[model samples]
Every structure is written in structure tokens, then in C-alpha cells.
Target chain A: MKYRHLVITDPAKLIFGTAPYPVKTRRGLHIGGGQVYSELNFTLPVMSINDQTLPEVYAHYRQITEGALERALQLNSKGVILEFETLLEMTKSPATGVEIVKIMNDICESFYQKHGLASEIRLTPNDLREFERPALQRTSRLLEPMFQLFEQGMLAGGDLLSIESTGGKEVSDEALMMCDIKAVLFSLAVLGVRDMQFLWEKIAALARQHGKIPAGDSACGFANTAMVLAEKKYIPTVFAALVRVISVVRSIVAMEQGAVGPDKDCAYEGPYLKAITGIPISMEGKTAACAHLSPVGNISSACADLWSNESVQNIKLLSGMAPVAYMEQLEYDVRLMNTALKKGAAYSRTLQQLLVESDVYTDAQALVLDPSNVIRISSALIQGDSYVANARNGALEFIEILEETLASGRMTLPEMELSYIPVLREELQSIPDSESDFIEMMLPLLDPSKFIPSEYGL
Target chain B: MNYILSKLLEAVEYGKVDQGSPYPPNLKGMDGAHELTQKALDAGIMPQEILETALIPAMGNVGRKFSENKIFVPQMLMSARAMGASMAHLKPFFASGKIKARGTFVIGTVKGDLHDIGKNLVAMMVEGAGWTIVDLGVDADAESFLEALSNNPGAVVGLSALLTTTMINMGEIVEKIKENAPGTVILVGGAPVSTDFCRKIGADFYSPDPRGAVEFLKQLAS
Candidate 1:
């Protein structure tokens, strides 16, 4: 509202009340833009979710999304939308897939219905056989339970330190905010998720409001879809309408925020998969919003500068996964992450306790012991080349906070993480942070690591 | 100093395709790799000299830049485009025996992986370095590699994969290629691949960047 072309690279920065000042990366009517990015990794251990907490979990998911979209509407006058990986998650049971698809459809249909945009939106049928067959075929029955566990872990951080009870849990306005793994999983599923067509279809009508879905700007996971498509030798027939739901929501905010800067950006990096399948269209007025393009081969290493929405889309249409050496970059980045973690652990007990578990010191230790969520944050930021402010890596944040808390002697690392809950509660659109499941989600970003110095060796 | 060759190298590094191509705006309307190579040849410069002095070194510079994160895919591909345009002029010489290749490199994305950007980059770089390239294309299984090796004896085979799942095929392909021809020097590169992976799979070498692959070929040929 205060500026033209407001673009956010790291959502965490915003959540931390450090939203970056708008910068013009390209020329266009960039009303509003935010990098609503997420990442997922199979290397992290997964956790199970009980049937009892499904309703609360679903509600929390809805609150985070609906809240974000509503704010997006305030910016662009058109609310963004969201979609879950129900279809891919349901691959273990085709019948269950059908049931979950119906639920997802209801979720989208209701959102559009409430917004009076339902008539414009169109959802698709179960179409796993087309682009996702290879992924589905690679599915092992043994891994089905693990996927469910991953979903649970993603939806609610691993039976986290703070989330003791889902039933009738009193969420006060003062509690810290947690992250939902669903968003991370939503993008991560591109590697080989089935029935994405159903999700993409729901996003189609939503695209009419914004025009083309800026794929790369959505997240690092979008580029991974190109690998999936190339592997399946599949190309989507309909390209313009589909976008990552997170982007659909964030762009609405970018639009409504209504930055009036010269050459305000509205175009973003098109998903590489779209280059093969989407009909070429001029991004002139069809430019929707800016997004983040990220690394796919391996998550956790800084690879390339974050592509602006302008160059990202133009580049994708120009080429389709032509110079494929990202995997090499991933390998190179992991070594760096290990080095950082090893170093940060040496200088601080805050980091050390994260790795060690003490019944007395619960919160930070919980995040340290559970590294999956931490990796998710790492995965989200590893692919960024550079940003207006900085990229979000939980470990790096931990390291930074660890250094600050030690120097300032003001708040402990766990207290610093807990401190943000109130801010998230204030900033969130729909639900209060007290009601949300964010402990495990925020832990990796908020906690100090427990790395023992390499010199100490113990 | 070969003034024309240096211009050619600069053209290849900056991705000046030809006089009319509108990319790399700073170098617009200037003679590109396409024009410079032809001019170098017209000046009686040997095709081998152009490959060595201009094309190879230029691609090497681009490859190193890519490793250092100084450039990205679009820029690298633009460089490749420039290299490809210049290399086109030398094809006839290679075919007619006027320019002898340093070696032959057979490359593909390996079985189970259809991604080819990395493979193509390596292919262009090796080709720019004066090696004959037999591209097996994506989804290449063991048989295609073995067949390529049989057709071009002493040809170095390159394997590429972009996914961890797809990368598994490299080991299988290497084992089969070694079984078929024990002395075949196989090179592997890709996102999930590492030098450790190459050694474990019994491949001769693995490079994280395209320039490294070119370096290996240069060493092998010597």
C-alpha cells in the first residue's frame, strides 16, 4: 500500500518484521510481490500423525492459507488460492486418492465460492497417468507409510516440543508461530508427485486474475518439475492457468499492495515445464507477480542469484532445462552447510543444546534433534543467488541469533524464537499463532545450533 | 598474439552468436563467433588453431565461470550458442580430415533420466575443444553406450544424470561399459553425481563442471 512493486524474497524476513524494501529488478507494472518460497528434503526423518488430530491440522492449514490470501486481496483486489498434495499423497490407494481429491476440490471450490470467483476457476479430473506415471510407477508400497509419516511431519512438526495436544489446545494470542510442512511438500512434490494435474486445474481459473503463473518465482521446487516432465517425457497441454498456490496467494498481496514504482514488475520466471507444454504468450499485461527460482539437484547450498520475475519467465520460455548441472551445485553446497554447522556449534552452547536433548531444556533441543524442518528452511534458501535483503536458512539464522544473544546478553536463543510467536500472531491473516502448529516449523530457523567446535572434536 | 583469435575467444565467452543476434546487448551488431571463425579460416588460420586458440579456451573460461557462480545457465547457454555457431564453420574440415579431432566423446543423460541440458553443455564444450561428439541423447541405456564405443574405438564415454534416482544408472552403465571394453575411459557428470561416485562406479573420472571434463579430455589426448 505504501509503495509500488513491493517484492519480498524471504517470507521469514517478513514474518520476523523485516520485510525488505521494494526494489525494481525489471520494468513493468509490478504492483506487489513477495517470495513465498518453500523446500522439502527426503533426507530428513519423517514423523507420524494420529487420526485424532486431522481436523485441527486441516483447520490450521486452511487458516494459514486463507489468511495469506485475504491479505493478497487487500493488495491486488483479487485473493490468491492454495492446493494440497492430496492426490500424490493418496497414491497408496487409488480409491483414497479419489476421496482426497474430492476434499481438495471442496477446499478450493469453497474458497472461490466465498470470493465469488468460483465460476472462473476450473478443477481437473484424476490425471496421474499422463505426466506423473513414471513417478507413480517408481512408488514402492513399502514407502507408502513413510510418505504418510512425511506428510504428518510436514503438516505438524514432529510431535514437536511445544505442541502437546491437538484436541482443545488453548492457543493464546501470545504463543510463538509454527510453520506448516504442507507448503514445503506442495512444491517438493514436483520431483515426482502424482495427480498434480488436479491441483494445477484448480489453479487455472485463479490464473485468469493474474494471467500466467510465474513458476520459478514460486519456489525452488518448480524447477524440479522440469526434471519430472523430462523424465516422463510428458508435457502439459494447458500451461497458463497452473501455478504454485503459494504464489497465487502472495501475488494477490503484491497486486493489492499496489506499488507504483517505474517499470513495476509483473512478470516472473515461468516454470521450465511450461516451456515444453504452454503456448507462448506475451507477458505484457499478463504479468502477474514476482517469485523465487531455486535449486533442485540438492537443497542446502547457495547456488545462483535469485532470478527476478522478469528474466525468470523469459528465460524459461527460451530454454527447457538445457544446461543441467544443478546436481553438481547441490553436492558443492552440502559441504558448505556442514562447515557452517560445524563452526557455529563450536562457539555457542545454544547451538550445542539444539543437537543434544535435555528434558529440562526442551524447545531448542527439540528443533536440533529434529533436523528435517531445519533442512526444509535450508532447502528453501539454498538455491537463492542473492536477494534484496538475504536468504532464509534456519541454521544460518540460528548461527546469527546465537552470535547476537551471546553478545547482547538480552534474550536466550529459545526465547528469541518464542518471541516471534506474538509477531506472527499479529502479522498472520487468518488464525492466531497460538492455534497454529509452528514449533517444529520455526525451530530450525529460530533455535541456536548445538555444533561442537571441530577443534574440540567432542 | 592472434588478435582475431582473441576476438573469437571474447565472442565465445560473451555469447555473441553472429552479427544479427540481439543478445549480449553490449556486443550487438559486432562480428560474432560465427563471423570471426570464418574470417580466421579465410586468413589461412588452421581449423585446429581456431579450435585450440579461440573456441576451446573460450569455453574453458565460460566453464570456469560457471563453477565459480560467476555465470548461470542462460549465460552459459548463450556462450554455447556462440561456440556452436563458430564450430559449425569447422564441421566440414573435421569431416574432410583437414582438422583432426583431439578425441571422440560419447555422452548421454543415462538410462532413466531424460534431462539433457548438462549433457548438451558438455557436448558443446568438448566439441568446442576439437573432439568429435557422438551424442546418444537422453534415456541412454547400456547398449547404446556400448554400441557407440564399438563404432568409435578409444572414444571416451560421458554419462549425465540430474536426479538421484536417475543417477543410479551411471554405475550400472559404467560396469557394463567396462565389462564390454575394459580400457574405455568413461567420464561421468551431473547434479547428483560426484567424483567419489565416478571412482566407486569404476569410471575413469568425474568433473563437477564442463571445463573439468574438457581438461580431462585434453589430458587424455596428450
Candidate 2:
């Protein structure tokens, strides 16, 4: 009777198109539906060209610079994010990344100078792989000039003065190296270098000591440095006191902000609590809330061309030619659970098994013990990607399960599958709606003449 | 290249489909690839010459330009369409063995990924280079790849996936094809696919562009 629209949802009254469940239960993790996860900033120039020469890449930046700067200004962002990794891959050295920082700084400086824009613009560096070299020695090579610019009070030209390496990797090696990196970051932060990011690692352990909700800081250094800026406190005192904030912020965000529950999600990745706590996140971490004068910049990159192509939905096929600026938002926790549950079934493990068996548990092992808590906490941290990755793996595993079970008459999906899919499609359709400029971007490519559904007569 | 084949080359490069096709409007009303290819054949031009000297070289230029970003997807697609128009006339000759095709090539986008643009481009470019292409379309799984290889013994198989999620699916398809058709040459590609991925999966060949695959096939035939 309800087959007319195919996708059915009564959002206010129904959970799963009328299957009743209490509000925002942890059990939501056991089912599947469309999820509104963070649509990340898949900034332009990702996967646009393969096997590119250095000149080609630089030419690509020049071609897109006007458009990119215009979009940044429209968004009121301090500056833009660029894919320096491409250049680094071309050079294959940490010192090269630093060299690229200077090149990028030149680009930003020229953009600001030419535009005659009064507000300073910066470029955010992302996907930093250089954990070791380009040390204080190398940093000073670039920094000394910046310090001179600051001394001359002519540092207003937006340049990538900051560095970001998402903590806890090869960057997490030693007290000496970590201290060295932090020491350089601190010096640059002082001399009007822009805010750097991915400096927060193992922040959960630190959060517990401060009686904060134990959350790992994927962007740890944000809250830490924000506190320093807030207290006008000695930088080391705040850095020493820094702990994970996203989970705490998420908890407060979920409880205090009613919009972030079962039905509603934050319209943008607003640091609502960061405003209250006076902790800066993201670009704020870089700027120290503009507390530090004209800090260095960050020029990060995006991948997959997934969100980068502005016309992706209409294009039927996306290439890097017409790139769109993108940003991400944290989906309501309930939605993450439901998505992990339903979509994850086709992957390596069920949501329950994912919690019990897979490394999803150990990913947050020291962080938390509860499965639901792990989903909430780990999903906000670096561990979330692996969960989605697990589902992708589950997609392959589900194929095997379907094959073996269908062959042996041992397994069939729960009967709810029929009613469930339309909702899944409906939820997926919302992605385009939210990204209205490229409304069709998230939809799978379709050619009725050629594309046949995997489930035909179900 | 001879005059007729040279015209064919220009037609493919500029995406002049046929005299009737309105694309590449400057070339409209002129003899297009469809007409020029036919004219070459009627003038006693060998099919091998049309492919080697004209079609292959034209597609090679297109591929090089693509890598250089002188052309993008829409342009590449246009060129592929023109190439297809010409290949339509040659397919019959290859079927009858009047014109020798080096070998058969079975190609498809892997299961779970529906993107066909890249796959289609590769297929068209490869076909232009004189191989008989059996395109299985998108969402082709390991079983389908194996079946395609079985029907065309000694043919090369190409698997494509655009999503990182589905790129893993390529590994399964490659492994299955290798296991079932142990001797079949496998070429893997797509946006995310790298030569490193090719080596990791034990696939025999990987190309970022369709021209690379075509050149690899040509080398094998030689």
C-alpha cells in the first residue's frame, strides 16, 4: 500500500518508519538507516589529476586561486586549504614540505596583496606527513623572516606560518621529538604564526586527570591552546593541562543542545561549547582566537573528489575540474549508531560484533569500556574512520555470508530488510538536499538501461 | 599517416563523431571519423593501418593531453565517442578475422561501484587500439570477471573501481580471476588505483590512463 514513494519515514512519530523505540537509546546502534555523518571539507584539488608535474600542479593552483579565495572570503574564513602533500610527494622530503610552506605563503601573500583585502588571509596546511625533519633548525629558517616581518609590523600578508600533524602517529615518537615539534609550534604561535592543528594526541588520558569527560582529541590542541589564550596563561601551563574536549563537548552538545539528539543535527560544526568553555577548535586553534597577532597559516587538503566537485551530482561523473569547497559536521550520536548498525551489517561484523570482536573496542580500549560509549567516544576520535572502513570490509564479508548462507539455506536477512531499504534510500537522498548546490552529489550513478539493482525482486 | 588516415586522426583528436554529429561544431559538415574511416577502407587502406597509424596515435595524443590536463573528462568522452564511431566499422572485420585483433579484452567496473565514465573511456581507448573489447558494464563481481575470462581464453581482463571502499573489491575480483583463470592477464585501473595496488593484488598490469593499457596490450601482442 505504501509502495508509491518507495522510501517511507514518519520522522516525528516513527523510528524506522513506525517501529517504535524510546528516544535516543544506545540500542540504536543495532539497526541500519541513513546517517548524517560529518560531511568533511573535501576542499578542491583532490584527485583532480594523476601523475602531475610540479608546474602543472602550481598552474592548477593559479587557475583555481581566484575562485578559491572568493569562496573563502564569502565564507568569512581567514584563508584557504591547499594540497601541499602533492608538492611534498614531488619533492619527497620534510624540508620540502617546509619549502612548500614558503611557496604557499607566497601564494597567500600575493592573493591578499592583490585583492587589497583589509582582513588578513591564511592558508591551512593539512595531511602533514613530515614528523621529524624541518625541525626548529628548519622552522627557524622560515620563522626568522616571519619574526622580522612581525618586528616590521608588516605580517598582515596571509601566509602559512603554522604547521599541523594529526598527533599520535610517527609524530608521537619521543619526548624529545614531540617536545621539539611542540617547541617549534610554540615559538611560531608566539611570533604571529597562525594556529597549528593535529597537535592533540592521547588527550583522553589528560582529560581524566582534569575531571573532564574522557574524550580523545583528534583536534586535541584546539581546546588546549584555547585555554592558554583564554587564561592569558603561560602557554606551557595550558598545554600541560590540556585534555580531550570533543567528547566532553559532544556530551554537553548532546545534552545541553536539544537539536543534536535523535532527530536534529547541528547545522554546522559549531564549537557551541567551545564558545562557552572559551576553547578554540579548528581554525581557532590555529589563530588562538586571533589572540596571537597574524600567526602562520594552515593549508590542508581533501581527497576522493567526493565533496570537492561543486557540480558532482549533476555531472554524473565527477572530475577535479569544477571543485567545490566542503566542510564536515558531526551527525547526532543516535544517527551514527543507527548507521553503524544498519550499514555495517554488510561489512565484516555486525555492530555488536564490531564492538565485541574487532579493534573498534581496542581503538578506545584505554579510553572507555562500554560499547555504546565506545561508539560515541571513538566515533568522534580517529577510530570512527576504521568503523566505516570496517563496514566497507563488512560489505565484502557480507557478500561471503550471503553466498554461503544462500547456498546452504542457513541465513537470510531479517524480514525488516524490505521496509528498511526505502528509508535507507530516502536518508541517502537527504545528503544531496543538504548539499543543495550539488544536490545529486551523493546519489549513486544510475543508468536505468544499464544499472540493475543487486536486489531485484526482493 | 596517409591523407585518409590523417583525416581520421584529426577526427578522433577533435571528437568529430561524423558529419551529422554536431559536436566539435567546427568540424561539422566535414567528413567525420565515420565517413573518413569508411573512405580509408574503400581506398584499400588496411584495417591494421587505420588502427596503428591513425586510431592508436590519435588516442595516444588524447591520453597524453588528458594527463597534461589540456583536456578533461568531457573532452576525453567526446574523443572516445568519435573513436567508438570508427571502431563500429572495424568490429565486423575483426569478428571475421579479415582484420586481426591482437587479442580479446574483457573489461568492467567492479561490483559495488557504479561509475562507468572512467571504465568506458578506458574501454573505448583500448578498442581504438585494435583489441576486441567485451565491456561487462558496471557492478561486475569476481564471478562475472571469471566468466568473461573463461569464454575468452588468453584474453586480458581489466577491473575498475572508483571508490576506496570498492577498490578493495578489486582485490577480490583480481584474486578470483587469477585463481580461476590462472593464465589470464589482468589489468586494473580507476581513479584511486595505483601501480602499487596493482603489484599488491598480483594483477599483471595497471594504468592510470586507458592509453597505458592499450600500449601494454600492444607490447604483449608484439
Cα lDDT of model 1 by residue, B56-165, tens digit: 88877877776655554446677888988998999898889887888899999887565565687688778767788999987899999999999999899999987554
Count the clashes in each prediction. 40, 29
C-alpha root-mean-square deviation, each candidate = 22.0, 24.7
Which numbered prediction scores highest in TM-score against the true structure?
1
Off by over 4 Å in 1: A1-458
Highest DockQ scorer: 2
| Candidate 1 local lDDT, residue A32 | 17
lDDT of each residue in A1-458, candidate 1, tens digit only = 11122233231221100113321221111111322111100110011122553454344334433443343333332222222232222333433333433443455356566764221111111122222212232233423432333233222211100000010001100010112222222222211121222222223323333433322112222322332222221211011111221222222222222211111112212111111111111111101111222212111111111111221111111322211122122222323333334454332223323222222122222221122323333333233222110122222333343344345653343332343333322232221122123223433432222111111110
TM-score for each of the candidates: 0.42, 0.38
Q: TM-score of chain B, candidate 2?
A: 0.86
lDDT of 1: 0.41
